[model samples]
Structure formats: C-alpha cells, structure tokens
Target: MKKLFVLFCLTSILISCKKEKTTENNDDTGTSRAHSEWNDFGLKGNVKSTLEYTTEEKKDGGNTSSVRKFENQFSPDIALKFDNKGKLINKISYKENGNVAEDIVYDGKDKMISKRNFTTATEYVETKYTWEGDKNTIIARRFNGSRLLDKEVFQYNNGRLVEHYKYDGNEKQANRTSFSYDDNNRVSEESYFRNKPTMQTRLSIEYDDNGNKTSEIYYDKNFKVISKTNSVYNSYNQMLTSQTFTDNGSLDVELSRTYDDKKRLITKESFEVYDNSKNKEEFEYDQNDNTTVWKVYKNGKLVSETVYKYDFKNNLIYQIVTDGKGNEIYNKQIEYTYDDNNNWIGKKTTVNNIVFYTSRKIEYY
Candidate 1:
C-alpha cells in the first residue's frame, strides 16, 4: 500500500514543474533535446541502449577463494533502450527467475506513458498517463488488469500547477488540493480538502528578500495553529539552521549546519528537545572537493566513521567503515574498466571479502 501511494504521488508530481520555453537546439548536437530521464542516471555520451547485470562470487568454506567462480554466471537484470536523441523509450526489469517483472514505455517526448508490473504470467498492475498542452500530464490512471484502481487529475493556471484532485476507482472524488502563489510567483499557501468544503489542513509559507523560504506554518480546519517551522540562512544564502515548534510554542526539533570557506557543508547537527538527544555528522574533503572522511556522532560520542579513497579520474575506488572503537565493520574496494569515452563498462566490488562483479553494455549513437 505504501508503494502504491508513492507511485501515485510521483505520477502527480511529474507535472508540477513550471512550463518553460523549449528551444530547437539546446545542446551542442543541434537536435532539439526533448525531456529525457537519462540525465538522472548520470550516464555520459550518446547512449542508445544499456544492459546491466551483476554476478556474485561462489563462496567456498564461507569465503570467496577465487574470481573464477563468477565466470559464465551473468544474468541480465535490467535492459534499457533509448531513442536517437538519447531519450529513454523503454525499460525492462528481470526477476530472479529471469522473467520480466516490470515493463515501462515512454513517448518520444520522454514522458512516461505506461508502466506495467507483472504479478504473474497473465495478471499485472498498469499505470497510464495522459498529457495535455505543453507536455503537461493532465491525468494518470492506475489499473489492476482491466479494473481501474485509482486516478489523479492535474490542473494548471498560466503554466503553473494550481490544483490536483484524486479519485477512487468508482470515479468518486477522494481528495483535492489547491495552491496559491505570491507576487514572486512562489507558492504562498497550500490547502488540502478531504472531500469537504473546509480544508483539513493548510500550510502558509513566507519567503525572505533573497527568495529563500523562511517560515512554514500549518493550521487546522478551525484556523488553529498546529505547528510552525522557521529557517535561517547565511549571507551566501546557504541554510544555517532550522527549528520546528509545536502549537504550544515549545521547540520540537532543531537542525544546524556549518559550511567551509568554499561554501560546502562540513558539519550538520540535529537535536530533539523532548528526548534531549542529539546527533551530528562531520565531513572532510580532499583537494578535488571529493569527500575523504565522514563521521557520525551520537550525543557528542563517535558512533561510526567512513574513509574514502578515489583515483586520479575522481572515481571512488575504496571505502571503509568502522565503529566507535575503531573496529572495522565494513569495507568496499572497486576496480573499474572504462571505455574510450571514459565511461566505466565493467566494475568489480569487494565487500568484506565477498566479491560482486557488475558489467554494463553501452551503445552510442
């Protein structure tokens, strides 16, 4: 049920971005770069398709004895295909038994149009999307086979998402949410109505001169304050601290952060007022700005620490974790084989004496 709710929220949030003018040539390739999920994958080059899989080393006497155990043991776990413009078109995930577990399809514009999750050879759960003007997803519907389960509808005003409605399988409205923006075009208030005229809860937001969110106050239907959160920022507009208070004005939780001269976060701390408990995390970076060490503390005592090592190409090669007493608990080492494009095609990872090999097959345009 939680997974389904998350999928429902993702379908609605997909169209929340404000519409922007798309150009004919946005990249150096001179092709109109339509929306693509490839950017999120951190993949480089003009990729046409990718097949990824992993194999675990065969253990003997509770320990890996040789790398030869991994040979000829590969099984395709995921396969993805992209269009000429590098837009994802289709993706398939394989189950452990080598059966297709999920299949997803995207339109030429890179918008996900359909996703089907197979529960058996014949039964499946499917979600379909409908788009309106400017690639706006207007409706999303989920179905268990031929029976509808739920549906979401989105409304936009001047390219800004202004309202969202959820409906059950019977097409009866379940809930509605509306948004109001301030003069800066930022969302100033959010109202949620649970199939009622009065909002069940409303959140009011305020921003500072730098356009940073400064406060958020939540109120009940009777206009009574429920909780409030406030944030403070430094001159660089970096968040310094945030505090949340209950309706009675008692501090509930507080979080603070410290940054280095380069404006990179170096330390973060959190405190719970009622429990009187605190936690902190500190980080150290190398000359290349890569994190070298990370430490976690509970109530000012070290709990865990991790050390990182990277290669000249800035690829993480090794990392080790230890407990408070400096006893090694976890260790990972990676070896990479890159293609001419400097993209890793194969990698081997060793974790606590256990080995796993991952390979990627990439095709360029």
Candidate 2:
C-alpha cells in the first residue's frame, strides 16, 4: 500500500533520533574525550551502516537445513545526516547491488522537501513537497523524467489532519480521504474514495464514557454494512475482550486477554470464526522485564514455544524456537560490541550458525 509521505517523514525523524551513538575510532585518549565533550556540546552528526552475510551448515537433533548464500555484502548501503536535536535532515538509500536508489532531503523545519528515485542509469523520478500557511497545508508533486505523474495535497484543521486529496497530472481530482473527530478529540469516522464523488469505504467508531473505543462499524461503497467490532475495556482503560460480527450481525470471532499487575499482557485467547477452537498465546517475563518465554497453543494443546535470553544490558542476544515435544526448529544468537559511550556499534547474528553482521559508524553530539 502507498503510505502517506508525511508519516514516512515523521517515522524517519523518530528513527534518526533513536539511532545508537558510537565513536569514529577505537582510540580512547583524545578521541574519547572529544566525543564525551561533544555530547555536552550538542553537535550535529551522521551515521553510516554496512551489512554482510555468510552461510554455515548446522545440525539440530537429527534435522539439517540449507541456507541461501548471497554473493556480496552491502557495504555502506545507507547514510543519514541529522541535526543537533537528532532530526533526520538527509537520507540516501542504496540498492542491495550497490547502486543509489533514492535521495531524500528534509527542510530545516524537519519536513521532507524532496526525494529523487532512480529508475534507470540516466532516468529518475523526482518528488517535491511544498508547504503554505504555517506549514499546516502541504502539496506534493511527482514527476517521472519530464512527465508529471500525480499531485497530492494534505490539509489539516485545528492541528489535526482532516483530509488528503490526490490529483492526476492534469490536476483533476482522482481520490481523497476525509477524517472526522468526536467531542473527545478522537477519530469518530473516516471515509475514502478512489474517484471524485464516488465513495469507496467508510468507517464509523463509537466510544465509551472514558473515551475508550467501544465499537467500530465498516461500510462498503454501497453503504452496506461490512463488519462490526465491539470492545470491552476495564476501568484502567485496558481492553479485556472484543468481538467482531459479520454483515448480518452474527458473531464472526472473539478475543480475550489477561494482564498482570504491571499491565503486561500475559495471555491472549482467540475464538476463530464459526469454530469452537480457541488458539492461545502465553507470555512469561524475566526480572529485567524481558519476555523470556512465549508459548502458542491450539485448542488448549501446546503447539510451539520460543525462549529468549538477554545480555547484562538487557539486550536480547539469543532466541530458540521449538515445537511441542521439545524439538528445536530455529535458533539464533546475537553479539554486540559497544563504544565508549556504551552504545552498540557492532551487531552480529547467527541463525543456526549462519552468520549475518551489521556495523554502524555514529558521530555523537
């Protein structure tokens, strides 16, 4: 599905901020002191990443598996530049075969300004974003070589996104989506269309007194009911159960959940459509608040189990998946190397002994 460009930009911004920080060199004298002081000074920085893979043969119990081997590693496939506050300003995505795929540039305000997508050695698609009036309204234009493909406009009202309209190259409206909110400032209805004045689908939602969602109804283009879902929540605003109904108002499926005192979900049971079978998922956490065991059951019979092991830093470093009767199906181990700042700079993973490695070069602020 085509995603909204603004959402993509927002996600990029978040990822840029959460990137792990490391040193440019291993020397811990002057270089280490400089990096430590830079953290106090709030300096701008960038990150470079490389990924490599290798295959190995392994025997678990009496079974064996073959792994696909890629001929080359993706060296320095991605480069990202960030501002002082860690907002993404520029991104260059490279193809697996070591070719530039796209270059995304962001404005000083952290809004994506333009993206260049490479189609051929000499051909490309260029998309530009334009903003107006306090940056609440945005227009995006896409071009393939010299030909315009489509244009889209996003509109916001009272700091809430309300509508998005898509137009053809000739500037004719092709599709649009509208959002409506309730008194509690929660989205109450949404409608979408593929062509002007033609409705495709609509969704309406109802909320409880505490502003928790209670029911959601979906409608087809012809205004016929497609499905209805009803949810029941506890006083803490946590969902306890939910039921989905078919167009004829018949129960289609149901789900129930149980949580511990920490509000962590412990068990989830699903009632299949038109079936009495109940599939369940159970979780167990360790002292570090990491899920150590995850089990899945079908019709009250254990089907599979996954165990997780973490390092002293609470970083998940090992995982083992087994079927019922304790037969190992998959195993993975991860190791990490940290920088002076205690940030992971290198990560290596081995799945059934087939190794994959990723290295990051981070400049700290």
Candidate 3:
C-alpha cells in the first residue's frame, strides 16, 4: 500500500490561503500588516528547515518505547521583484540543500507557468508542462528528463472549469477528468476515466451552511453508492465528526470530537482501525488552551503520544513523540524570525540536534 504524508509544513508552503473562513472575528490577522511593513521597510534574508521522523511499538503495561530519529534538511533563498502590472514576480530560488523545488513564473497576465523537476538515484524522473490557451483551451506538454513525454489538454466554458484530457509520457490521451460546479461556485461533482469518464464511479461534494465541507459521496457508474463520508464541525470549523459508509450505507468507521471553552479540541473517539473498537485519543492543553500533548489509547493500551512546544507568537517550535515503551521516536525542532518589517526572514529545522535544512528570504523594493 502507498501512503501520502500531507505534512503541515508541505501544505503550508504550497497552499497559503484557505478556501473558507470559520468566522469573521479571526480575520483580524496581520498578513496585510506584515506585507505592508515588509514592502515599506523592505526585507531580504535566508530561511532553513529540517525534518525528523520516528515510530515505535507500544506494549501493554510497559513504558513508552525508545525513539529513533531520521532527519533531512532543505534550505532555499527567496527573492521578490515586480512586473509591469505591479504584480509581484518571483525569480530564481537557490536551494542550498540540493532540493530543486518548484519555481513559479507569471506572464503578467492570467497564466502561471511552472517549470519541471528532475530526481535523484531513483529509477525514474519527469520534466514539466508547457501550456498555451486563449479563453477556452489549454494544451500542456509533459516530459521525462529532457525528452518530451506526452500532452494534456483542457477545455473550459466561461470561467468555469469543465474538462481535462491527459496523455501518456508520449502524448497519448490516457485519461480525462470532467468537473461540475454548483450555483455557489462549489465543485458539486466530478468524474474521472481513462480516455473518458467511466460509468463506474462519480464523485459529489457537499457543503454546510457556514460553507464548510460537509460530505463527499462516491457512486459507481451504475449509480450505486460506493463509499460516502460525512463531516461535522465546531465553531472554529474544526472537524468534530467523521463517518464513513460502505455501499450499503452501513457505518464502516466513525470519529467524534470534544472541545474546551476556548473551542480548542480536547479529545476524540475513534471506533475504527483496530480491535476493541471504542478507543479514544486525548489531548491536553495549557493555560492558553494551546494543545500541549496528545495521547491515543486502545483497550486501555497506550498506543501513541506526542508533545508540542510553542513560542510567544503561538508558533509551533518543537514536537516530541513516544511509544508505549517510552522510547522517543520522533523529534522535530523549528524556529522562525522576522525583520522590523514583520517579514519572516529566517527559519531553522533540526532533528535530534542534527541540522537538516535552513532558508533565507531576500526582498527588494
């Protein structure tokens, strides 16, 4: 089986903005302030990062297990410039740690072009895409290393995305994905296929009154339900309930949550994934209601636990994890600094005292 690690760090860097806000009160953020201050005062510097991972088995009646750590570092430099339309333009980023991350480019218009990426000692690699379009069609080129592989095409109506066509590494149409949107501009349904949509499976999405994602249901091409998920939320929009169903609409798994007066999540019950089904995960908070530790228990067995440390700004600074044997398996340390302009100018990451990566932000007027 394959696993996807959507690490918070990865998501934060790639996806900066949220599609919805839980409440208007939380909108008094300092993004604009930081941006303005950074612009007026101008900021430039370096930032660095590192990651450490570990896991251990928990034994009944035994202490937490020993923690073993693996670490890696990534560092980069960011420089900012402006285009004719006054839109910010990103130039080259030199990754000091040999990580060739994605680079963003703009045409000073509506299009954004992303460059290709190469790999390391792996058995395979891929280049990137080249696109050309007007108001209706987009053509993309795929490549392997320096060789052209295949092409992908997209057709749209008005500003609504309608269809996607993907080809092989050599430009053969391999798959197509079509999309449908609701009146509120939310993606209501989607279908995917090899060469075209299949009658086997289609997907639908739903949202609640506060605009929070409420559910996703997948149906076979025969219109028979395949799998469905239901979601619940708190005032902060944090997930409170998650229920999964099988084709017969039978509950396959479910989770529920509880929060404190400050709306901070305090505990969760998971009746799935293992035996003794009605296990629970507990979280403890500090005076400020910040989550300090999390614990998972199954049949009175301690399975997992984690502790977090935070800085004055409420930014996470460090994390520690352990198994039932009391072994420290995962430890991560991160720190950030800003200039007078409030621009985050530097970052540091470490795993068990081994520095993995760091980065600096360079700014220009």
Candidate 4:
C-alpha cells in the first residue's frame, strides 16, 4: 500500500512535470524498466536515507534545545540513476557526514542491475533492477534480517501503466491494482483487486465540459455504491470544493480549496479523523499550500499545535509539536548537506532535549 500510493503520486508528479518519456521494456525475469509504472510508480529498490544528530543552544535556557539527542537513523542505500539510452547507470548512496557510501553500476537510463551496500559488512539489505525498454517492467527490493517485507510488479501497455500487483507473502492474494484511460488519454478508471474481479473495489470517474473531474465513485462487486466524491470547479478549471462520503453514507472527508489570482493553490481547509467521538479536526494551509501550522481541538478546546519550516530544497527543515501551554512537547530539527557524488550526507536530526544523544552516519561502497 505504501509503495503503490507513492507510485500513484509520482506518476501524477511526473505527468505534471512533463519530463516523462514513452518506452516499454518487456522481460520475464521481472527486472525491466520499459513500463509506465516506473514513471507512475517511480523506482523500487532497497534504498537508504541517512540521519545524523548534534546539539545547540536555544533562546530559553531551561532545556537543552541546542543539541540532538538519541536515535540516529541508518539504512542501506538503493536508488537507481539511469542514462539517456534508458539504461541503468550508477546506484548512489551517502553517509551522515556527507561522504561516499556506495556507487553501484547500472545498465542504461540508470536502472540498477545490482546494488552493494557499504563494504558488504554488517549490511541488512540489497536489491536488483531490471528493465525492458524505457519503462521499469519489474524489480525487487529485499532486506535479509529476519524475513521479507514486500515485493511488487508493474504491467504496462506500450508506454502506459495498466496494472500493478503487490505481495506481502501473506495478504488476500496479492493486492492488485489496474488502471485505464479514456479517449482523451486521461485516466478514466482505477480498480483495486483482491485477486479476482469478483473481489474488487472499483473507482469510476467522469469529466465535465471543461475537462475538470465532475464526479468520482467507489463501488463493490455487486455494483452498489460504497463511497462517492463530488467536486466543483470554477470557469478557470480550478477546483473550488470537494466532499467525500463513506460507505455508510456518512461524511468521510471534506475539503474547501481556494486559489490565488494566478490560479495557484493558496489555501485549503480540510477535515479528517472521523472518530465521531473526538471533535473532527480542521487544518488550514498557507498560500503556497504549505502547512505553516495546524491546531487540534477537542470540543473547542485546543489540544495540540504543530508548526513547520522548509529548507531551500523545499524539504522539511524543522517541525515543532507542542502543547497549548506553549511548552514544547516534541520537536524535530533537520539539516541536509549533500555532495556531488549523487551520494548524500550531513543530514542531522535532534529529538528529546532532556536526554541528549547525538549520532552520525558515513556510507561507503
């Protein structure tokens, strides 16, 4: 579910970026990259992102806000970097100190044929990539500690993703997902599989005269409406509002959107966590659609608040999770310093000021 959702978002992002290529790779070994799923799903491999820690001083001297304490993150790096020929190139990774971790070779278009994590010593993971053409047809990401976590596949037609299947080794017959498009070359339907069509949750959609989504619905095998969503759009094709209904006919989620004069997303108000027991929480965003801050309330009484800050790379730099007393409950500070080797490093994080712990990471091939 995690990989699938990520792939779905990447596909949309790729399409939005308009840098996507059209090519398909057909291979039986499940290591090809010619399918649209890679563009949609992005890459699948045992990847790693390093985390580091340190300390510093805060304005209020009561607690040690200046240092990072406890738990530095460490993982195997496994990301594919391809070339123009659609062949896999080098697999890149980095350490916490901004050092070379690993550099694995790829075929063309940067599809990783093999990955070696850090001296092959004390390693817990490895991955292999395969492709047919420009599309990533299949791949496997594995970790060898105790057991396997996930494995998945993508099916494509020409240069478009048609289906995706995932297996947890245990689940209801490998959760399968299929995609389809309309004559306008726009996605028309997406179906979730529970092995067979008889066990499917299908989502069907319709477009309006302006190419804006008009209605979206979910249905059970019996063709009964399980849930539905309705959207309204302005003449400029900007979404004005969207509301979703649950399978039980209750409001599941609601969103109100607003755009700037430039039609860019300026603000969005959302409601989630339908506990019915707890007051439905609300969220507001900034002009950039960035969540500057959010508050949770219980029956009009504020409970918690979270604030965010982003870096020049648009990455989350810091987050403060606090109580209404303005007293800090939990906090996170991050600094990512990258290198040119495609291997990353110098990424830091600080947590729990009371108990100070600092950690660092450095990766090697």
Best by lDDT: 1
Scored by CA lDDT, what does every candidate get? Answer: 0.75, 0.68, 0.56, 0.56
Q: Tell me the lDDT of candidate 4.
A: 0.56
What is the alpha-carbon lDDT for the whole of candidate 1?
0.75
- Provide the lDDT at 41 for model 1: 50
Please provide, for model 1 over 1-365, each residue's C-alpha lDDT reduced to its tens digit, 9 standing for 90 to 100: 34433332232222111132233334445544555444445455567888766777776787764432231212236778888767778888766555677898876435778889889866788988878745555555555657888888888888888999998889899999999999999999999999987799999999999989899999999889999999999989999999999999999999999999998889999999988999999989887677778788989999877788877666677777777899887677879898875667887877678787878899878
lDDT of 2 by residue, 153-248 (tens): 888888777998888888888999999998888899999887958779999999999999899999999899999999999888989999999999
Off by over 4 Å in 3: 1-88, 91-102, 106-112, 120-141, 144-146, 182-185, 196-198, 212-215, 234-238, 273-291, 298-300, 313-318, 330-350, 353-364
Against the correct fold, how does model 2 do in TM-score?
0.69
Which runs in model 4 stand beyond 4 Å of their true positions? 1-125, 141-151, 166-175, 197-199, 208-213, 233-239, 247-249, 259-268, 272-274, 277-299, 306-321, 330-365
TM-score of 4: 0.52
| Model 1 spans > 4 angstroms off | 1-40, 60-76, 107-110, 120-122, 133-135, 139-141
Specify the poorest-scoring 10-residue window by lDDT in model 4: 40-49
lDDT of 3 by residue, 216-280 (tens): 99987777889899999977888999999888878888889998887877888887643537788
TM-scores for all candidates?
0.81, 0.69, 0.61, 0.52
